[model samples]
Target: MPSATHPSPPDKSRAGPEHDLTAAFPTMDLETPSAIPTSGQCLDHLKLLEAFHVLREDVATTDGLYGIHDRFVDDVYPSKGLDEKEAQLLFRLREKRWAIFVANAERRYTIWFQNLPSDRGRMPGQLALAEMSGYFEKTSGIAFDSGINPPLDILMVWHAHLLNPHDFLEDCIRYDKKLL
Candidate 1:
């Protein structure tokens, strides 16, 4: 059979899988975002996730969730600090007195997230198991979804605060407390 395709010179470029675009990019490695499963410890994070979820529903009702999409799974409820947009969001969250809120919020959230089971392998994680077994919301198995995103968001916010803990802590100073 006559080969219609022009063959490249050996000196010019290598042939076979090495030269083929498909072969050259056979497998693409991508960073998969995991759900940050947790047994709720930070009330603010829980509330915020619910707000974000509600925001999603509202926005979708207005339009149709076109640009925005949910995180990987329920485990990692809120995928935080994974991008520039999110950084901007956190930046907004820490505006003026709000920084104090995020400072305290993130500190508590990060502490809780860090304390979560480090491993999520064959066995279900501590948070997930607790949820399924109705340990969290014991009211007829109506547990709060301790999403991955919220804590992930906390991780980002907390780390940002950690970058300058003293400054943030100082910023968190309430003059009312000193008056007492």
Candidate 2:
């Protein structure tokens, strides 16, 4: 057999495994995004799991909800603080005193305004579960719809549990008499 000298086997002893892309760069660590999840993403998943666990515990303990005295904050309702312009607008409307008209109408037509968040709050499905139809009727004499238009100074109302006795007493005293 005749021996011929070639390129000396291309120095494959230094080359690493077929899957070793990291071999090119010693400092790099190769791993898929799915293998090691992000902290923020993991936290979100954990929160969801915690919420589910709490719901299950509540259901097991409460036995299908007897009157549902929500201790935790709902953060689903709508509320707003009136601004100067808003106050002026409402004031002007009241000053008209249309009820005093001696022509035909005896009662003043009442128009109730409600500020609801169309997005970033409670979903429409959850609202249905809470039986919000009565709330809608009492507030605006209509039905509650999630797709309602934008509101002025719309904010979400969170119904937190009354953990403190002082807060409970303060709220009771503050709202004791609607009219003084």
Candidate 3:
């Protein structure tokens, strides 16, 4: 992992000409809520935390090139092909989202992240997209296609269905009505 102090940014020269991602996500708050917040949402935050920890560990024990992977993963979001600065920017954005989730517990919220399905045609290559959709489908009281891959594929939504806000609400309503 590379030292955070001298972390390399992705090369601007290698960036794809078709898109200007820096402009696309000018700020983190521009992101929309694709699904409601739940424990899986919190776990995603934990994953980012773990990723960050791994980067720190690499920086401390190795030459810091390993640490650069964290930045690389960040920059490669959505479409890929980003410079180092862009990658760091992406990491910071995700970190901000994680922070918000940690700091605010009372507020009802939603989950939105990078690399989601913008075009229906792009779905096949994206397994995470399918997973998130399943989670939302099952919990949101909406029917997701049964054929779609389940949320288990992405390492989110593991057995904590009760942590899902929709499922939580459904259980509450059912209990209130003496249906459970």
Candidate 4:
């Protein structure tokens, strides 16, 4: 695996203009609930804690969001001719084998980082998109068509702190719920 400062190897199958990834973005349905958090409805720390306390008392399963993803993913939303920065992110995903949020027109998948060590104490680990061959697709909650490969549009890059005002979260990256 490459270091965070480096990019991954050259591979057309990973991501590029040849991929034609325009049809991979899936929209979220507001009526149903999912384990993943969506967009447009995030709260600050105080509101999060208050909501958590309230939900703790009730049996209502409040599947909310910690934070939203940044705009980098949006820049490459079409996933055509992925630039250096975009390719670098994909290389990180490939190297780390992080369970990223891959989307097609129909569904989303959570590709997990199977090689990560479990003994990180209280610190959270990163999920990266490195190589396409290493994707753990079965755990991602979607069944893809034979020739279909989605774009790695959103990644919920987790952090280990909860000190944000807009998001009562350790951290969030590429966490747009609308793109789920």
Candidate 5:
């Protein structure tokens, strides 16, 4: 008796923990696909975009501090300066280099995450976080890449903690002030 424009409300009697909506409405076709990305895909895309922006900014800042752009031009073509096209290409190359570096770091982190023990609960992770914090506190004067790398387990926790920037900053300020 329902018209095409106004369908009857779904039966409340059929709605319960054991009720299956698909079985109740076989013709509803709830599995229809769309162009929209899933929430996980959207999150991955957003993270990639943010990482791209951060890499671009880091490259620009490094160039400004070290005169990498001028050095590139001088080393590649001393006699004649780069044209607009060549300048753009140089920028792209630098961006690509930074992207590769970031990609490698992400790959390492992924491997580290995958190798974590399944049986152990949060204790291992908490210990790694503590170790990472201690490393930062003790190595205040040492360069990050000064021939020493933090353990992968510690780095994994540090990386995850860093994703929540506000919490990380607050914890750093409270307990690990030297890390700031």
Candidate 6:
């Protein structure tokens, strides 16, 4: 979830008559106002990811980016819940966000394997695990920031380590108490 201090992105898809599209994109010429694409007309993957990145940075804990679509909608419409039309729009937005995240993760996973030496042995995986541990130790006291990403190999190892919660916790406690 985004921190209370950070303002939520406007729901431009449902913007009223008073909403000014030109103001949002100052550089663009809006002589023909219809040229301005609404969120429904076209999905901007990069823009959406950038917005998600901002929201991710505001989150203070691990796994904070998970289920962000739901959190964002709930946060924006706290008093009056979404109507049927709004619900459909939100569903589309959530689907796009999920697709973008999965695609990026897949790309990173592929790149991680491509960068590895052809040796294809236990040593490479072990080294990644070790490196992941070191990364955790080095960044133990730092606040969570989505912008600071680990190398894909170390990230893969970290993901695997997280699957075994007990062992991961025990290792963190033993090696870097602050990580816990």
Q: 165 in model 3: Cα distance from truth in Å?
A: 9.6
Which candidate gets the maximum TM-score versus the true structure? 5
Which residue runs of candidate 1 sit more than 4 Å off their true CA positions?
Answer: 1-95, 120-144, 151-155, 158-180
* lDDT of prediction 5: 0.45
Candidate 2 TM-score, C-alpha based: 0.20
What ranking emerges by lDDT with the best candidate at the front?
5, 6, 3, 1, 4, 2
TM-score of each: 0.23, 0.20, 0.19, 0.17, 0.35, 0.27
Model 5 segments more than 4 A misplaced: 1-48, 64-70, 111-119, 122-127, 134-180
Identify the runs in model 6 with alpha carbons over 4 angstroms from their true place. 1-81, 119-180
Model 4 per-residue lDDT at 33: 73
Candidate 5's residue-wise lDDT over 47-165, tens digit each?
Answer: 44444444445544354333344366456655454565445555655655555545655664443333333333332333353454454447433223222244433353455667899
Residue 10 C-alpha lDDT in model 4: 31
lDDT of all predictions: 0.37, 0.31, 0.39, 0.33, 0.45, 0.44
Model 4 Cα lDDT, one tens digit per residue, 1-180: 334344334332434554323322243244667676555223232333443333222211111211223233345555555566665665443422222221221132333222122233221235433332234355443333322233232121211122353463211332322111
Higher-ranked by TM-score: 4 or 5: 5
lDDT, model 6: 0.44
Q: Estimate the TM-score for candidate 5.
A: 0.35
Q: Go through the candidates in order and give the clash count of each.
A: 14, 5, 11, 17, 0, 0
Best of the candidates, lDDT: 5
lDDT of each residue in 1-180, candidate 6, tens digit only: 222333334343544544333234444332445756755334333333444443333332222244545555566666564655455545555555545555555564443333333333332333353454454447443222233244433344455557799987775454433223
Order the candidate numbers by TM-score, best to worst. Answer: 5, 6, 1, 2, 3, 4
